[model samples]
Target: MNIYIITGTSSGIGGAIARHLVDAREGVITISRRENIPLSRIAKTNSSFFRHYAFDLTQTGKIPELMEYIFTSFKEVKLNGIALVNNAGTIDPIGPSGKLDVSGIEAHLKTNLVAPAILINEFIRLSRPLKVSKSILNISSGAAHKPYAGWSNYCASKAGLDMLTQSIAMEQSAEEYPVRIISLAPGIVETSMQQKIRATSAEQFPMQKKFADLYKNQGLSQPDTVASGIIPIIFSDKPESGTFSDLRYL
Candidate 1:
């Protein structure tokens, strides 16, 4: 049996990916901060191989133990672990550079960069003996490459995520570790996150109108559309390891 882990399953790309994976009838373990009440039952309709963990990814200190628990829990099963999607990320503390919230920066680093690396570390250690193909897909953003005024913290975190993905890829390639890493950016998708930012006061969020106009005119892609492109890349034979990719390429 093949196993995969995906973080963030409440909504947006995370939920879309979960549904897609379930429909594909593959064994999956999904993580989210809130309970996906419908998902447990929905997943069973097409696939019996599904599990979920509702926990905060920001708590990096507890992750190693959690990974150990998962390793031990699944020890009895024969497994080929393919992918770990670091889809749980956030863009917060949005403000000018000088007035940026340090707490938000810490939160961004923990969720976007630190936790993913720690999870990868633990998974690699635990799965060393398992004879399976391995891959990691990190959900980054165009914000990482482009400059967004008042988005300094978000940009830095995702930029760090991109770098981290590259570093991991290089390390794995050097060691011939079976794992491959790809950092992907899902551009301008319509989701609740966008809504929240758009709802904020204009004075507090100056970019809201520009973003709203962009979405209104450009027609933002749906989460499902992004997921469709992501699914193929995860299993693609093309060599995109240690690289950043835009969904339009697929």
Candidate 2:
């Protein structure tokens, strides 16, 4: 059986992806700061196939131990494939770089870059001997390529994440069993993150009105729709490692 581990599964695209996997009878393990009630209830009936862990990804020091525990728990299961979806991210400190708080900037980097880096490192080390397909999908954004007035922190972190994915893919290509990795931009979706963006002051985010208008005009993609597009890429071998993709183009 194939197993997938997804972060930020408490809501939005991560939650939708987890739900879809569970529906397809795939083994799914989710991590989030809080429990996803719907997924928890469903796991009650499919205990062996679904698992959840309430985890704060910002605590980077504890990730190695957490990964060890997760891998050990599934040691007995014969697996065909295993994947990691780095979907947990933060878009705080949304303002001009000069006005952004240092603490908030640190927190943003920790969640969007540091935590995923550590998770990918540990995942590779632990899964090295598994003799199964291994993949990593990083949920990136257009902000990584385009700069926004108030999204300095978000853009920098995502850019770092995309480069990290590319570097790791290159290193793994020479290995006997390489892990496939991709950084995908999911496009604008109707998520809590978007809500936060829409609520930002126009003085801070000059483009706030653009996002607000997108919502007003019902132009935002639904989480379920984005998840449906991403799920196939996660399980398929269509995209080459180290490449970048956008859901709108696919």
CA lDDT of each candidate?
0.80, 0.91
Q: In terms of lDDT, which candidate is strongest?
A: 2
- Measured over all alpha carbons after superposition, the RMSD of each candidate to the real structure, in angstroms, is 1.8, 0.9
| Model 1 poorest 10 in a row by lDDT | 73-82
**Model 1: pairs clashing at backbone N, Cα or C within 3 Å:** none
Please, what is the TM-score per model? 0.92, 0.98
lDDT of 1 by residue, 110-129 (tens): 98889988998988787777
Give the per-residue lDDT of model 2 (tens digit) for 1-250.
Answer: 8899999999999999999888777888999999899887876676647878888998999999999988877787889999999999988989998898888988899999999999999999999998899999999999989998889989999999999999999999998888999999999999999999999999889999999999999999999999999999986776789988898998
The residue ranges of model 1 lying beyond 4 angstroms of the native Cα positions read none
Measured by TM-score, how close is model 2 to the native structure?
0.98
